[model samples]
Target chain A: MQGREILFIVLSLVACFAGLGVVLAKHPIKSALSLVVNMFSIAFLYFTLEANMLGITQIMVYVGAIMVLFLFVVMLLNIGSDRSGMKILDLKLVPAILIALLMFSLISFQVLYPLFGMQYPVADEGFGSPEAIGKSLFSQYVLPFEVASVLLLVGIVGAILLARRKA
Target chain B: MLEEFISNLHPVLAIFVRIICFSGIAIMFVPIQVWWERRLLGWMQDRVGPNRVGPFGLLQPVADAIKLFLKEDHVPSGVDKFIYYLAPILAFLPAFALGGTMPWAPAEGLYGLLTPVADINIGVLYVLAISSLGSYGVVLAGYAGNNKYSLLGGLRASAQLISYELAMTVSLAAIILVTGSLRMSEVVSYQTGPLWGIFPYIQNWNLLTPTGLVAGVIFFICAIAETNRAPFDLPEAESELIGGYHTEYSSFKFGLFFLSEYAARFVFSGVFATIFLGGYNMLPVRWDILAVDFPGWSEWFYFMHSANYWLSPVAFIAKCFLGFTVFVWVRATLPRLRYDQLMSIGWKSLLPAAVANFIVVAVWIMVTNLYGMIAGYASLVVSAIILLVLYLNIKAVGFNESTSTKRRIKMAKFNLKENEESN
Candidate 1:
């Protein structure tokens, strides 16, 4: 009915399509690219939600840096030729499908029937601006911010060590 | 009807104008730069270059573009076909994306038309982040080609870029210290007025100040290396790796990579202009002079004022082109350094120079603020001393003496095997 709703629907469709492509694409590189597309579409959704910093960071960190690294490792292994020769409808797949279905049903049930009868907060003005995020990050989430950065640094050091060949 | 349409469609038209102006200037400059390089190289080498392609080969780029378009689009078998196709587009996009954040000129009076797509608060940071993304294309091209040469080229390129990036970031931090803002417009504004340091009598402009000049020079060299131009183009060295990362590419895909290189060169030139040269400031004191002369020359200056609006875009383009010419000049003059030499320059020389310059600048800022002395003169003196010390140390160390000897031994080992096989 409204422009914002239409945009949200379009973005959601794009994310769904890209997510499906991530699974369906035979080549690992193509699958990685599909994941990038999915990530980008999710970033668009974040933008529409007015989470500008989060949206940009999602694209910058995940799609730009991390996905490139993913593609790098995939190509280095030369997995392009591994696409063919297998079509299995296994008993193992049934359990995974059942688990996914159970999870989705549980999530839907929780959403529809709130045990505490509490409602989600409505979107407020300045909900996702830089000022709002900055205030919240510094004031409310200061420990988490510092902890996350430390964890990131550790991961970066670990990655460098793993990637470096034995001298 | 026309006036109403123009008024109603102003915002959309402004976006269109930017798209046209930026892309048109970039596209036009690419050919001009190519021709300029060929002619310059020709003059340097004592030979005529492309004389038959129309009037000293002025039309040569057009001819070359046509040829490239008509050429067969060859896809190498056993390559990652999708990624190989995507590589050039990825390579090209970041170069274009970087242009959006660069403030080409100062805002117009009253009407307030500003140059650049958007004056994002984090302009410098945005440019750095986008430029860093360029490594992805090179890395992807290398891996996707499924060629050993390509893979090695990509790995080397990524490593080189990552190494230089640290020095580049440190150099930028020095600029940020002086400017005190990440925004380009603020940085340019800070450069205005009689040159004085944060303390009394300190020179303001980064180019004029000692630490700023060193940082600027370091930043310039790092930019050149980052773009993989001559003296740092080991990723595509014909002598060693054949064709480097894009060896398997053909037709328009290859063209995209080629275009992106020139685009990147242009973008860096604009960046240097914005940072060191003072973007959109015509004369050093043009803003000051104009403010004083505005009322007196109101009638004539009105025409000049309207003309100034148009001139902002022209000034930006002229600055960018001047930057490109300098890049071309360096490419013509310098011989390619060996890969080891390139790494050593980045790691041993530039990195240390940048770090030392940053420390000197930081100290200068602090001491001047504390003692309340003549900050500009002190900063200049301190920076000069640091630079002299760095140069003396570099000279005394003898950059490549031991490394060249080791390389010679390695080459000798290869030669001995060849001789044994032949015998």
Candidate 2:
């Protein structure tokens, strides 16, 4: 394999482990931190894909902003580790594991299906540029983008309403 | 020799050399900055500061570093050992890494041999992302310290950072709109154009333009808050939190926190210099434009232009130092803001001003493209007036009466409690 492919493989491995760390970590803060690592690794994966804009946005939004708020809340609440030591074979674990496996398999199949024999298509010039992304969003996917933004605004308003104290 | 040495190396090796060289230079400035800030602050406060360590205390940071190195490292009990160890390194890395996207010189000729290690397209966003990462160091440090003061400091740092990030981003958005490129180099080059797109004799640094002035002011304020400098430094208010996030740290670890703060200050200054202060140009005059306009003095103008261009890295460094001086100046001038005041300034004032500037710049650009310059200016004036009127109305209706009523009720309740106590 080329160096790029090898590098991608290494990054993806790191990302997978970090994802596991996020779910498996006992302490809430540790879990949040693992999720940050996972996000950063995924951002690197995006960088490797040559989606520079997407990679930076992922870091800026998820790791930089959202995970920070997660950390803040976790820290503020002073939560501790779960020491219940629930058995792996618990009834709740069986269905959770089964559903997780099913979803993983489905996602892998969909992803790997495209790369079975065909080579990846070459990216167009400036394909991952801000201008290109902006143009495409405005011209082609404008409706979805606008709708998503409106949905976010609604979510924000709803959150404010829920959090507001009554007189 | 430097150029030949750089060019002769393998591409990957060359990049490494550049990264090391640039980072070393930036890191070296930290001690100098420390010394300068001390002397400057001392001067401002009418006292001699650190003058006994070295000549004008030039070697004070060196002495400080030595002391920190020799001092025994201490780990307080009940601390999160791993995170406690990790925090300082975390703080230091992002601050140093902030230099990665900074263009010390234009990517041309002699000066371009070794600087701006990354030079990626999304330079501004990269800065924002990395800067946001910086808060992790402070936040994590606070958490790991296992102290209530540390936790409060960490919480405050996180909230402050997130709030200011919005204002900083929106303020920079105006510049991005004006430049139409996310690349740092492009932003610099755009500034090299004719002043105000009218005067051919002067360079159009962002700070000189109307919308740019507003954005620059807001961005600078946010940068100050982002670095936790005085006035906005509620997170680490020593009087309240006893060194805040680093209260539990001592020895080299504490030194690391100190180094990172100064380093971040230096680099953030460099960024402000690049964005608003016209990158590396010696002065705001366009020698090239003069060279074209007046052929009789063309040789002299060309000479001046070349001097400005080739010595750009030096100019960039000087600008960064100057910006650092301004940072120190600001610290000396302003008092530490109260926590509520800090939050309100970040959210209510800076954010709104930045957003308004962004909208005005966007409108200006759109109008300029559609009609002409005059029409664009007209639209700018009209839109600004409308925004001002709307802002006043919103303030009058939403804030003035309700706040007054709330204050009155609160005062009456306080009085009633006082009377009850007397009885």
- Evaluated with lDDT, which candidate comes out highest? 2
TM-score of chain A of 1: 0.83
Candidate 2 lDDT over residue span B64-171, tens digit each:
899988888988999878889999998999988887878888788655767778788899999999999999999999999999999999999999999999999999
Output DockQ, candidate 1.
Answer: 0.26
User: How high is the lDDT of residue A139 in model 2?
Assistant: 96
lDDT of 1 by residue, B1-423 (tens): 543443456685776765665666776788888887788778877898877788999999889999998999999898777788888988898887777767776654421343566665556766766777787788889888889999878877777777787688789878887777767788777776456534322225667766778888998898888788887888888888898998988889999998999989998888887887767655444333454556676566455545655576677678888887777778778999887898889988889888887777677777777776576457758776877787887786775777888899999999999999999
| Candidate 1 Cα outliers beyond 4 Å, as residue runs | A1-7, A49-55, A77-92, A108-160, B1-7, B10-13, B109-114, B197-205, B287-310, B347-423
Q: For model 2, state the Cα shift of residue B273 in Å.
A: 0.9
Q: List chain A TM-scores, every candidate, in order.
A: 0.83, 0.84
Clashing pairs in 1: B196-B202, B197-B202, B202-B376
CA displacement after TM-score superposition, residue B292 of candidate 2 (Å): 2.2
- Which numbered prediction scores highest in TM-score against the true structure? 2
